[model samples]
Target: MQKLTIQWQRLLNDKNQTCPRCSETGETVNTGVLKLKNALAELGIEVELIQKAIDFSVFENNPLQSNSILINGKLLEDWIGGETGKSKCCDVCGDSECRTISFGENTFESIPENLIIKAGLLAAAELIEN
Candidate 1:
């Protein structure tokens, strides 16, 4: 299998945390993506909403985006496989890990950077013409 490539910049400036789940937070974020996505799909939805209390805390240390990729999304499953290996346990809740989310045109798989730039230019041209 191809190794997953995840490149991301931290959302919050501060990485320090006194949260209770600091120890396993990393695991939670990683596994949560897969589980969350699957859950949403089962419900016949394309998007998954993760409230602060239900999802990861907005604690000073928490990231706006935990990983480079959002789990349960269209493109990532090819790399992450099904909900068995990487997306099973909830590193955060320690519940069964029920929630799952998907990708939109804004997502990397849908609108890659190159396409975004091209589309942006086209929109800009249309605006200028108007």
Candidate 2:
């Protein structure tokens, strides 16, 4: 079976806690992965999810890197024709602005599961085409 990889990264404080946005996105990602697995199984495609944690030091320099998702090695926003932006996050982020995704008129701090599933489906389509 072929494989589709979805990678999500977020900032982790010393206590291994992340901002609310990242935490919610993590839950969405997990749900998305499960959905994708079921949806793609018949197509001989395997769904793989990789969760990465960015240290506080790294987040201090580039907070925007946190709460990022990549499908098939490409940004989720790229796959979905969304725009990437940033906004001030919660205390776990410590005054840093975290990543946001903009689609049309709406902008989301915590990425929604629909977007994740959409990206995963698009990626799975590409995998099959190739």
Candidate 3:
């Protein structure tokens, strides 16, 4: 069977809590991954999700890196032809701005599951083509 991997990274505070945006995105990602697994199973494509926690030191340097999603090693935005932006995040993220995704007129601080599913389908298409 072929494989498609979805990776998500988010900043975690000392208390191991992520910002509200990241927390919500994580839930969306989980749902997206499950949906992809079921949708792609018949196509012989296996969906895998890898969630990573970024250390405070790392997030401090590049907060934009937090709450990032990658599908099959490519940025989720890249796959969906979206843009990456940053906005002020909550207390768990300190003063650093967190990652956001812009899809045309819509800008999301917490990524929507539809976007994830769309990206996963695109990735799955590429996997089949290759």
Candidate 4:
């Protein structure tokens, strides 16, 4: 059986609250990915979405992308980024020299459901992209 993989590495920025943009993006990805999972199950295709909100410091040594969506271990920019792609200030990780993780691809706040759905379909592995 073949399994599709969807990974969203949300790098935490501020201590008080997760970045609004990232928060929304994460929620969209989670919900969309879950739906994709159930849909693919009928085809006997497994889906794995790594649900971990990692810190910026970890991204420094992260094998995968920090603020990006990866499908089947491939870094493909199909989802949304933060307001600014630059690192933001964080009091909690101040001494740690860690800042908010940004990808700089979006000027908006939310990741569209359609985008994640597209990503999910692409991650199916068996889908033929023409």
Candidate 5:
């Protein structure tokens, strides 16, 4: 089997508060990855998987929902099944109240579990399919 690489963009940068929602999203992706790893392991599938995370702020020019799923560098937007809302305050910031974190339109606060799972599975299968 080949190695699969999963990459995700995070909305919460180093400057902002630790967004639980974003963390939850990361956990969801990791869980799916774990599932794939274990299942493949049982089959003696020699597959190597690596998850990559990037800050959304890097794409300063484009802010048109880059938080998408990718299968071998190809954006699988359909698999990124998360509903994106307009710009909003940082609900996960501060100790007791929500704070305003200025992130451009491209930032993704959270990704739905379904998208993550689908992406994970796709990447997993891509290892064997490719």
Candidate 6:
């Protein structure tokens, strides 16, 4: 299969999509493609799969709602703080887990994509058939 490269901006413009985390946007960065790509590439599966598989949620304006990535209808939690686990605080409480000796190290957070891979294929296949 040809590698799929989805420009972040282009994909986020789709009217049918919404950011599951913050609900403000469903942009590409929400999928953690850039960060997860390195880890995923090790598995031999194209990072494009992240774009292919996205899951959307209802649009609601709530401050409590996280604007992070969603994986399989779940918020992509981060143990490490910041973008891609660099200088990140605790995913929980957003605390400085790194600096405080009492606080443990940060961990990996998993965010959900706007579309799930299976759902993406279904949508793609439907488009093709039509």
Candidate 2 clash pair list: none
Alpha carbon lDDT at 29, candidate 3: 97
Candidate 2 per-residue lDDT, tens place, 9-124, comes to 99888897988999999999999999999999999999999999999999999887899999989999999999999998788888888899999899999999999999999999
Error of 4 at 114 (Å): 1.1
Per-residue lDDT of candidate 6, residues 1-130 (tens digit): 2232332211121344433332323433544455445544554434453333222221122112333333333323322222333223333223321111111343323223433232333333333354
| C-alpha lDDT of residue 27 in model 6 | 38
* Cα lDDT, model 6, residue 15: 49
- How well is each residue in 7-54 modelled by candidate 3, as lDDT tens digits? 999988788888889989999999999999999999999998999999
TM-score winner between 3 and 4, please give it.
3
RMSD of 4: 5.5
How much does candidate 4 score in TM-score? Answer: 0.62
What overall lDDT goes with each candidate model?
A: 0.30, 0.93, 0.92, 0.58, 0.49, 0.31
User: lDDT (0-100) at residue 56 of candidate 2?
Assistant: 94
After superposition of all CA atoms, the RMSD between model 6 and the true structure is: 12.9
TM-score of 5: 0.54
The lDDT of model 1 is 0.30
Q: What TM-score fits each model? A: 0.22, 0.97, 0.98, 0.62, 0.54, 0.26
Model 1, span 46-107: residue lDDT tens? 33323223133432233323322332232232332312121222333332222222333222
- Per-residue lDDT of model 4, residues 1-130, tens digit only: 6777777766664463455555677888888888988888897788887866776567456423434667777554433323223444244334332223233444333455566776577667445331
Q: Score residue 111 of candidate 5 by CA lDDT.
A: 55
In candidate 5, how many Å is residue 89 off? 5.0
At residue 10, give the lDDT of candidate 1.
20
